[model samples]
Target: MASSVLPTPLLKDELDIVIPTIRNLDFLEMWRPFFQPYHLIIIQDGDPSKKINVPEGFDYELYNRNDINRILGPKASCISFKDSACRCFGFMVSKKKYIYTIDDDCFVAKDPSGKEINALQQHIKNLLSPSTPYFFNTLYDPYAEGADFVRGYPFSLREGAPTAVSHGLWLNIPDYDAPTQLVKPMERNTRYVDAVLTIPKGTLFPMCGMNLAFDRELIGPAMYFGLMGDGQPIGRYDDMWAGWCTKVICDHLGLGVKTGLPYIWHSKASNPFVNLKKEYKGIFWQEDLIPFFQAVSLPKDCTTVQKCYIELSKQFKEKFGKVDDYFNKLGDAMVTWIEAWDELNPSAAAALPNGPAK
Candidate 1:
């Protein structure tokens, strides 16, 4: 291991992180390793006044969502609890030139080689060089294409392709949607360049709110717009909404959205419902499926999809016998995935490259 060097005080241009957490102290402890080197703002949604044990040398600001809303007005939108914490935190702290938000459950992978980080920095500089303003989106897997579908998108592997964009990686959102149409077979893998990629109007990506970075100037004003009059958040899909807002803003500004370079690994807790079939109802019944069920509003006509959900729910209950049993099974699966990931991608398994303090 390298000698521990204290991260230099934050620079105006470096990425600062904001994390929203609830009652998972264990999860916070696991996240400590990645929090080093960045300004860490933790929003304790469950209890605002609760004091957390943070590692020395790390800067932390704790806030309760409830208190924020009461003090800031309904526009604070810290109401939905978990998701709201993210929204509120994004709105409040984020003082650096650039801001990066990651989920509390996520662990940062080791920092990429200096060359790769430089490449990412250059990519951002080039994207924002145009006369017009622009918004950038973070890349992630299982890319969401809005509210309708959640999966089935190609992943870019070529490192230098300028036109290629990796999911959950990095993107600039324009303020307004462009009249320009998406060119088919969206080009993949090339050196970084300025370009516009299109999705159907109103399309939202399954965003990994776990790891997103953006220019403070571009995202700051937009965050205010997302709040309800009462300070409640209007969109359940903050990342997706932010992405869409960026597109709209850029198109109107004559700037274009570009996707490219450097991949970000999302270390947040897994959503087991992602790929499970209803026939696997046994899985859902045993585990808590309320959130998954609510998050995914699949069409009824999609019988195959419906069946997959039903079966998974049934099997989950049958196999687990109790919800506790289901949780155990889920925990086992997560552990297995983590172990497998460590074996397969040793480099990505390290602390988050740029994340909140411990």
Candidate 2:
């Protein structure tokens, strides 16, 4: 790690760095070069009695399990107790326009050039730059320096949609499913792809929350990580559930989602046997869940993020309730999530100033 470094300019103060963790955040030491300058919203999951400490000097607001129960009151039931899903609590409490969330185990990754990758800065650029979701750009990110739309690209769609989410990737330990992790314990991801592809509208992607950034204003309310972990039957799919819901909402609202680029060094892999127990149900459940998200069509009246999300919750109740009792509870949790979101972030700060053009 560098002795001292500068934070990403202009948006530094306006953006909040959200991290969800149960253990002491010694990982931030590696990120201090890029993150120390910003405000951190640390969502301390599990055992509030156990104090989680951050490195000295970084400005942060730490909310523990007890704090969450107190703050959201009845609505706190929507937040998962001993899971990363509780991280969304940081999202709810945040007043900033941009949110960059990374797991405590993820470290800074270096690009092929051997230079330390500034994942935070790249996410900022992704959020600020336009996303061409309507049409795939052959040359990848047309807005990236030295890149442009191919010859046959449509002029009408060139401006593209406002990117609501920037989904990043990981290097070293990959985010594989439990079965895969168990089978390939020795496998590691050394391939670093430089392109950032906009998830074309109407398509779904498995979103890993380990390293992610989103424009909170454009799609904040829809960014709930769903009800998983602790008392719930599901686990690990917290980010996946949020991604599916958010993607549908973003598509209906004419927003965009991009993935790849700004990779992080995933330093640790969770125990596969433990992960297997948590993921067993979701592995099968997602078979039905995928089609539901694919078929979802938000009504024209459901324009705002909250409206879209509430409407999505209704769909969850109507469609998945019959699938299992857990779906029904998840549906209820979804509604509660919206209620808590609205109650906490009362005034919608939707208008966020864009970063300078590339």
Model 1, span 250-336: residue lDDT tens: 232222333332333333322323212211433333234433332333233312211222333344345444645533433333233
| Residue 7 CA displacement from its true place in model 1, Å | 9.3
* lDDT by candidate, in order shown: 0.37, 0.89
Candidate 1 Cα errors over 4 Å, as ranges: 1-15, 23-35, 77-79, 110-167, 170-207, 224-236, 272-358
lDDT tens string, model 2, 151-226?
Answer: 9999999998899999999999999999999889999999998899899988999999999999998888888898
TM-score of each model, in listed order: 0.45, 0.95
Backbone steric clashes in candidate 1, count:
72
lDDT of 2 at 335: 85
**What clash count goes with each model?**
72, 0
Per-residue error (Å), model 1, residue 245: 2.3
Clash count for candidate 2 is 0
